[model samples]
Target: MAVVNEGALKKMLKQYKYKDLTVREITNVISQYKDLKPVMDAYVFNDGSSRDLMSLTGTVPVSYRGGLENCL
Candidate 1:
């Protein structure tokens, strides 16, 4: 599982404070945010499963278009 530091986690919460963001945007934040990059890297390089990552990241699972989707 990816471990998000306190600062990065706070920044992430602030980013989502105003409005809802698309999944793509969330992915972009994970990749682009400097602090979050380490968490993303850990997920990518450590053979971390998507489910595990999502759970750690506080993602909400939803049913959309007859498929499972993630929301935050």
Candidate 2:
């Protein structure tokens, strides 16, 4: 099982509250701090499949704990 970096996620969320980051930005951001797949699924938006990170937002990450970039 993958682990959730709550500290990193929390920091990303705080950043989101201040500004909007693009999917690429978010992708790169999380890549620097934690695992990509888990963070995208748990925090960003997703249909449970792989897709360009730029297209998902607002809808997929609806009930997420973190708010960084768009979901994968």
TM of each candidate vs. truth: 0.22, 0.24
lDDT by residue (tens digit), candidate 2, 6-67: 55544545535432344345555445544344233343446665432222233233335675
For candidate 1, which ten residues in a row score worst on lDDT?
A: 34-43
Best by lDDT: 1
Residue-level lDDT tens digits of model 1 in 3-72: 3354554454443443234334445555544233322322354566532132134455578999977665
Winning model by TM-score: 2
* Model 2 regions more than 4 Å off: 15-72
Clashing pairs in 1: none
Clash tally for model 2: 2
| Overall lDDT per candidate, in order of appearance | 0.43, 0.42
